[model samples]
Target: MTLFRHFRLLPRLVVAIVLLVMGVQPLAAQQPLTRDTSFTVASALRKARKDNPTITLAQPAFPSTIQAQRNLTYCTVGGRPLQLDIFYPKAKRSRGYPAVLLIHGGGWSSGDRSHHAPMAQQLAAKGYVTVTVEYRLSPEARYPAAVTDLKAAVRWLRTQAGTYPIDTTRIAVWGFSAGGQMSALLGTTNGDAQLEGSACQTSRSSHVQAIIDVDGTLAFIHPESGEGDDSRGLSAATRWFGASKTDQPALWHQAGALNHVTAQTPPILFLNSSVDRMHAGRDDMIKKLDAFGIYHETHVFPKAPHTFPLFNPWFDLTLEHTVAFLAKVFPKRP
Candidate 1:
């Protein structure tokens, strides 16, 4: 039998797979968590500095090697113009390059697209057209608004398909935390009109060929989920869902990526941290993926922080895994 057949029984099996394939550290060695821990580059860096004070936050160079078009308005919703940044290689390709939409995660309320600038620049330098986009957060809008805004971004990409150095058919979404959940949903629900909101009025499709979900919860109602815990003084999920799980159970389930997965869903890559709660419904989703014979890969960095993708060592590894998976899913043209 395949090692993945017993996904429920072997949640840590992913760690072993990654360790053997990538030579990453063992799962037993994890960082210690604190009481008042937060999930942000700035907040995590403070704790990471304890280990390596010299470690600095990743920043984009003023005159980067790659070409960058920053702050281009992609969509206008409710008088608020949503913006996006595009990064492309200096040498334009006649056939265009694969594009990746990088999404930032801050419980769906706090982060901006700028958090992914460094990552977009690096991917551009490595021959991919990358985009970082802004969406209406929970404080600004609610539930489907963020999803609608993201789909609008995809449509915007289609509008600029031939104009920019991007291959519209080979686009993908890579997101972290809350953005991760959105990414998975985007991948699974390709062309679902309900999520394709009025943020943009384009006939283009929001179909992503691939998805990379980093530490995003797939199911909010699952036993593994840590969302909607009012004991912590208004959890992130509750705020974004607009009510308690008991108050609006259907909405909570509607937002879950696990419920949306289908045989037609595109390939997916799950990059995760040590936090079990973050891996909510991941194994189950993989079961569905496996049953459908859909392509998927899951890599777990045991004992790593929830926001490891923003911090070094982990960030570098994340990029390595990302590039490798993208190459396998969408091979470069000869």
Candidate 2:
């Protein structure tokens, strides 16, 4: 009996020693988070910069020979001046070129135009005048505030077309996550008076030539309301709309992009990751698009997580697919 007890104690002591060794081990000995495959955007940017030093945060200097400028304009939302960043491309002819406006996503509480500078620069490099604009976030400005700013940016872009190399008729809007939802709103609810009354009302057309929505939510109604699908928890909607799921079901529905789709909506490219939670809303939006017989494409990637735009392996693939989609949807004039 004593010998058996000693044997059991010996195994326990060995296990304790192993735990101690692991606890004292240097962090360097542990496997690093896969640099190129990190799901976080910051990590991806770090890896991207490591791989290509030229992908810096700074925007490229305007080419002196091409004739270009960087301008900021203030659009009022509930008596506050929200600023926008415009990158005008230089053109040889007097005719304006197509323009693409980008909206950044931060769950409607954070994020700014600077967050999307790299993508805007890429678009500018592709021969399109690009504008990345900032909008008011929640707890300060609520629903329709961000949407209003986006429409104002469009109107402002059109008004400044002569000064900038922008073709008002060929304008397009691109966004990620929350921003994507806003872009979908702009594309589908062009005539909605409540949301478009301010800056968008006077514009000849609030309609965009095309829309690029990246893994954005389209419905406010919880997908799991009835079946205990806790996946549709009210966290995101509550944050953005400032109301509990049970408190304002009607308002939530009204704010949903899927609720606003119509036959006249512009062509769209819906890009999402297979593992993303918002893919359901994206699917709903696609269904609406299908019901309307609207031209659109859906590109879903396997194993890519939500907000994959901020990472590398997936981001690289996203860029390739986006470029191809853009070419297909908005081909350059011959």
Candidate 3:
């Protein structure tokens, strides 16, 4: 009976020996695949949908005079179809316009580009070519993938400059929360060879003229003591880096926007909610920028949540402020 059992296990042992000799490792020796955070984000979307029943997945109603295009398909990020909605002023306007690229935030895991369609259309109506882009989410795609896709989108727009009536020299990036982090990174690390190589190799310029970071995490270095605990929680860093605070310190810092700041960074506009839990490190980023004498403006909205710019009253005010700020920075062509 013992001999019979040994004979039965001989084939398995032979296969293991063959794998070992071929340098093929078992799945157990490899790192487990990361779980997608999109499920949780999808749940939040469902809640938002329920809470705001009137918020249909429809294009913003722009005036007929303005040429608004919806669901203009863009490239796929990691095999997933990504897209952007473009709003352009009519050609008869007799002047080219600056462009604004708006990125939506849902913790880097979820949020459609269309979330900012209304705002984009509003900007377009104000004579700017507005593009809201879609990027890859976490777990499915990891750190730098989102940033790569964003830079790709920028390069794509630059290629279409003449066709879209965009002022390639004056392009600016704007985002809320996680999107803000990406925009800030895009502004600061414009010339980074690693992040900008794959997608933007043909592009000579990576300089975004300005940035608007709304209640976003600017620094990856967390406070020594804070109201929100990093214990078992989801954040942009965790989602992108795929490691806990204790597990991967080096990667966390590498992925941080603060670590990449340089004097060449474009002028920045930072809008924050006074009551937001993540406000501490953003001040550190401002201090770093100030140390470098980089141009910047900041606004703190009292008694508001993290992404207060998305809600009404505050939303209207933010748009107004953004328009005024952009006008001051990138004036319309005469």
Candidate 4:
């Protein structure tokens, strides 16, 4: 019996020896994995800033140091496919790079993910993996729908971390206008089940480590907010809620980013125009942020418009502030 057992095991041992000699990895040694490289956005941005200390009036005309992977379908809503574009740094990082989810502003009505592609590329070139996303718009879908879609995108990004050179722990969101509102909500509403829509990758957390709001409203109830009805048929906010402010005041309050702030809320950076009425409740929200001992910063560009981040001079300044803020909040790994 012992001799018979030895003969049966002989073939397996011989095969293992042959594989080792031939340098063939056995099935158990193979893994579904992505190769990591030692490259980072922080190091690249630092070098870029040092090489060119002057801020330019327009996007640099030179070849981009990033690679753009366009139109990746991340989720679907109402049978419509939602897509996101990813910008990858040319330099490889072994530990992976911090990520930013860029949401466009179109009053929750218009605008597409492509709107922020240039900015995404710019950030990617500096060593970050940046993505621009598309969400359900108002009139077609009401309040929380867009937020849900955005959250789903976050989950999708997290799920793909293993396949991409991304640091799942250091994801952030940046938005403009309506997109800023969504970004603020994403930052403050982390771990809240109510806002996590029934989108794909539902098991993952949608929480972000940092948020950058460019002229996005923090409080809709504030008198200065332009979202409420102004003797018009219905305010944009009311339309978004699918009910008038008088009918859904609770929903209005729930949608306000200020309502969700707590010590657990991620650090935020507000970039606004000196005179933009959209940021009416900023002071009050800032007070809350301070009370909660959260780190926050505000930069008001004098004489700039609400869409200043889209233009030069202001864009350069915005980028400067953003780079500094992100560096402090999500430092690169060695």
Top candidate on TM-score is: 1
Tell me which residue pairs clash in candidate 3: none
Residue lDDT tens for model 4, 188-274: 999998999887998888989999999899888878887877486766677678887777789888888998888999999999987
Which 10-residue window of candidate 4 scores lowest in summed lDDT?
35-44
Instruction: List where candidate 4 sits over 4 angstroms from the true fold.
Output: 1-63
* Cα lDDT over the full model 3: 0.73
Give the residue spans of candidate 2 off by over 4 A: 1-71, 199-204, 222-234
Q: Is candidate 1 or candidate 3 better by lDDT?
A: 1
- Per-model C-alpha lDDT, please? 0.85, 0.68, 0.73, 0.81
Q: lDDT per residue, candidate 2, 105-188, as tens digits? A: 766766667666666766666667788887777746667677877877777777776677777788888888778878877877
- The model with the greater lDDT, 3 or 4, is 4
lDDT of 4 at 38: 21
CA error at residue 153 for candidate 4, angstroms: 0.5
RMSD of 1: 19.6
Ranked candidates, highest TM-score first: 1, 4, 3, 2
lDDT of 1 by residue, 166-198 (tens): 888899999999999999989888878787786
10 residues in a row with least lDDT, candidate 2 = 32-41
Residue range with the least summed lDDT across 10 consecutive positions in model 3 = 51-60
